[model samples]
Target: MAQAAREPDFRTRLQEWIPKLVLSPSVAAMVVFVYGFIAFTVYLSFSDSRMLPSYDLVGFGNYAKLWGLSAWWTAIVNLGIFASLYIVTCTAIGLVLAIFLDQKIRGEGMLRPIYLYPMALSFIVTGTAWKWIMDPGIGIENSMHLWGWTSFEFDWIKDRNMAIYTVVIAAVWQTSGFVMAMFLAGLRGIDNEILKAAQIDGASSWSLYRRIVIPLLRPAFLSAFVILAHLAVKSYDLIVALTGGGPGRATELPATFMYSYTFTRNSMGIGAASAVIMLMTIAAIMTPYLYAELKEKT
Candidate 1:
């Protein structure tokens, strides 16, 4: 009996450790690759590194110079416009789609996948496709002209004044569906009893949503905002494949600026500084949501 009890205890301990042992390698890689690089980048931001890593400390010199640059300012302004429109448009479209789907309309199963199909494609692919569709000579304008609509004009992609909005349109096309999924999940999780009670209390559909349904979806709203804001701040590939930060830097977001400065311009220190600022922006958006989530759990 003593031997059997000892055997079972050993087996139980082995079971408990198996998962941890399996996860250790991933945790170790994350520590070394993810966090280690982050720390190194932060250090480089403070140093006089340019073209390559340098150990000479320059303090906030890189940051000061970065703030003074006209290109950096242009990137900042473009990001503000892109992020604002991206977030608002995505949220509005996603919320509306979610609400529509929640009503259990016919072909619900078919429609959900159709709505989400764009998101399955990588941003690079989406950007490239949109680039073709928006090109003046071969895209919408050309096609319209060939069809005898000679006066048709849709050349926003080449226009400096309207290029950033084109980015917004592409981004919204790709991400709004994902936001829809988030809101849909939130809607599904809501208790049906509450909705029923509101209906019995003589609440109209609009009033019901405005007062109760929308209020309860606060968590979804916050989540969508945080996600969209983070994406907007770090957007690179989509802009690269679509606009290449062109029309004379009309869509030069911080990500593109960081890459161009660090690698091409040989200003690693300033690039690192910009990267740190971007990281901080993401952290600022994430920290509050994480705290609220943890607080609710506790």
Candidate 2:
């Protein structure tokens, strides 16, 4: 009897230990690669490291210089514009698309995939394709001229002032479908009984959606905003492929700024400072949302 009890206890202990043993590698990787590197970056930001990392401390000198630079200011301003437009435009377009799809249209399956196909492509691919389409000499403008519409002028990619909006356009095209899918999932998860009750209370279609449906989609809206905001802040590949951060630094964002200073300009300390700032910005946006989400779940 004692031997049988010991065997069961051993099996139970083995089962518990197996899961942690399996998960240990991933946890260890996150600790070493993700959080470890983040801590190293923070340390380097205060050190006088350039061309290579050095341990010599410089207090806030790097940060002061970063703040005073015109290029850094331009990157920050550009980020504000791009992030704002990208989030708002994506949310609006996605909400509309989700609502349209939720109407149970005849070809819902086919149309859904078509809308989402752009998202299936990588940002690098999307940026390269858009670059060709937006190019003045060999793109839409050239095609239009060949087809006898000589007056058509779509040269925003080369225009300094309008170049950032071109980034916005490409980003929205790539991400809005994903946002739509988020909202669509939220819409689908909503209880049908509540919707029917609202309809039975003499609520017109517009009133039904406005009061009941849209209110219930608050989580989706918040999720979309958080995701798009993070994407906008870290956006490097799309800008690199599409604008290369300019006709003249017009589309430079924090990510590009960090890379330029670190590798190209040999200002590693400043670059690390910029990276730290970007991390803080993301944390500020995410912390409250995460806390609220956790609180609600608890």
Candidate 3:
């Protein structure tokens, strides 16, 4: 009878402590900082506000104006450019680097660190460096002339049509290292015996990679592709630092546009609409990848 009474006490104690155990302080922090912030942003989006939050509700006025803006259009166009360039350049360069580094290479340990070190730097630093290097009058081309490589002309930063490419280049310089690491990790997982068998079957190095190795790295490629795509979609910081949507708002992107509205223009309603659009765009692009990730997890 005493043992039976102890069981009830244990159950009662467990019930009382369950919430504490399940909802940790870290979890509570996520709720307050992440989920709570998302909720606040969403709530603000539905309201009519300027400079500060106003509870007076206005429906879709912000959305209409945001859609009508030419700066917004430029942002949409540049987003496409940024995504296309970043995905293609990063994947191609990263794959090449991974394959080269995978070879029985001299100084590979040092080389790998050299490639990956850029990832440790923030975009602010990267942007500053790139701005200097690509500066029309004072940068590489000017120095090249000093070195007698006078035929070279590297002046993309000042031209409106070409400034966006400079942004893409800066982004790739910073991010390709991360993709290289991902590809290198994938390469390590591949069996060397399979590669030897391919060589025994008279496959050239190019043929071996194209036919066997590339296909095997699909999961890694998919993962990296999604990551790069998400980064491209959300890109703003590097562009802001490098160009500031410059030369008549030529390099504008969605996030930057939202920022312009929210802070610079003090059009909070339009900014909120842009934010919602950004969320929707990301969701639309990610739905397929998200489904695959979920299915794989299960």
Candidate 4:
């Protein structure tokens, strides 16, 4: 009898331990790779590191230099433009596509995948393709010239004044489908009875959507905003592939700024400072939303 009881207890403990054992490596990886590096970066930001990390503390000198740099300011300005346009454009396009798809359209199963296909490709791929498509000498402009529309000028990728908008365009193209999927899920989860009741109450389609349906998609909107904002903040690969932060740093973002300073410019301490600022910016946007979400769940 004691042996039988011991066997069951052992099995129960084994089941619990197995999951922890499976999860331990991932947890440790996060702790080390994510949190550990973050802490180390923070330390580097306050030190006098240059080209290589040094433990000598230099107070806030790096941050002061980072702020005073014209290139860093340019990156901040570009980020503002890119993030704002990226969020608004993606959200608007996604909402429209979701609403269109929600009409019980024929071939939705086929069409949804078509819309989402761009997201399957990495940002690097998207940017590289857009780079070719937007290049004045080889892309749309050249193609237009060949097609006998020589006046066509779509050289925004190489134009300093308009280069940042190109980044926004590529970002929106890649992410809007994902946002649409999120909103579509939200739309489908809405209570159909409420929609029917609203329809019966003589609500026009516009009024019904404005008053009831769109409001119900608040969670989806929040999620999309957070995700798009985060993507916009950390957008290095896309910019590298697309503009290489070129046209004289017109499309430079903070991520690129950090990389250039750390690896290329050999200003490691200032780069670390820029990285810390980027982290704080993301935390500022995320902390409140996460708190509210967790609070609601509890």
Write down the TM-score of every candidate: 0.91, 0.93, 0.90, 0.92
Sorted by TM-score (best first), the order is 2, 4, 1, 3
- Model 4, runs deviating above 4 Å: 1-23
lDDT by residue (53-107, candidate 3, tens digit) is 7777777777777778988989999898889988999999999999999998999
lDDT of each: 0.96, 0.96, 0.88, 0.95
Model 4 agreement with the true structure over 1-298: per-residue lDDT tens digits: 9999799899999998999999999999999999999999999999999989999999999999999999999999999999999999999999999999999899999989988999999889999999999999899999999999989899898899999999999988898999999999999999999999999999999999999999999999999999999988999999999999989989999999999899999999999999999999999999999999999999
Give, for candidate 2, the lowest lDDT window spanning 10 residues.
Answer: 114-123
lDDT of 4: 0.95
State the lDDT of candidate 1 residue by residue for 51-73, as single tens digits: 89999999999999999999999
> In model 3, which runs have C-alpha deviations exceeding 4 angstroms?
1-8, 11-24, 149-151
> Each prediction's Cα RMSD?
2.4, 2.0, 2.5, 2.2
- Give the Cα error of residue 44 in candidate 1, in Å: 0.6
Judge candidate 3 against the unseen true structure and give its global Cα lDDT, from 0 to 1. 0.88
Clashing residue pairs in all predictions, respectively, total: 0, 0, 0, 0
Cand. 2 Cα-lDDT? 0.96
Q: Which stretches of candidate 1 lie over 4 Å from their true place?
A: 1-22
Candidate 4: residue pairs that collide: none
